[model samples]
Target: MSHILEWKTRLYLFEEDGTTKARATLDTGTTTLTGHGAAHRNPADTDVPEIGDELAAGRALRDLGSQLLDIAERDVESVGARSGERTDPVLGWSL
Candidate 1:
């Protein structure tokens, strides 16, 4: 069977008081998840806005990915299947 679904993600970045912060939201029709991250530049380091933005955004996305995985594990368990029992390398590695 072929399935088609659309999920949307939005990321926002801002800088305040030598710190750059990022917020990311993922909407999957039935559920929404959010993640946050921040980057701080040391006083002795050169100030680079772009670098800060990249660091903060990457961290936020990583956090969002972790949440997605957690949700998937819980969902699998809800369906009467053990979440971590798969032995296929591809499936095992994913969990």
Candidate 2:
């Protein structure tokens, strides 16, 4: 048997000057994680657009990784409970 889960997350990025730079949407489905990047350029600084894209995309991916780890930890706990094994929330699985 296989377990499948889907989660949606959005990240908003702002420039150092307090201006909106980019927005990212992350779709984590089953066994895949996908991201969409959008840029809001500031005519004053062309570099800001690229920076925004990088930050937004990176942040979205980091968030996805956190979610995946959380799911794995929960699954480990479930298995350990069924087998009368003790699992440490901090150190993870124990045999």
Among all candidates shown, the one with the greatest lDDT: 1
- lDDT of all predictions, in order shown? 0.86, 0.56
Q: Which ten residues in a row have the lowest lDDT in candidate 2?
A: 82-91
lDDT of 1 by residue, 38-73 (tens): 999998999999999999999999999889977777
Off by over 4 Å in 1: 85-93
**Candidate 2: Cα lDDT at 46:** 60
Query: CA RMSD for every model?
Result: 2.7, 8.0
Work out candidate 1's RMSD over C-alphas: 2.7
Candidate 2 lDDT over 26-80, as tens digits, reads 5665455443333455567666456666766675666666666666667766766
**Judged by lDDT against the true structure, how good is candidate 2?**
0.56
lDDT of 2 at 28: 62
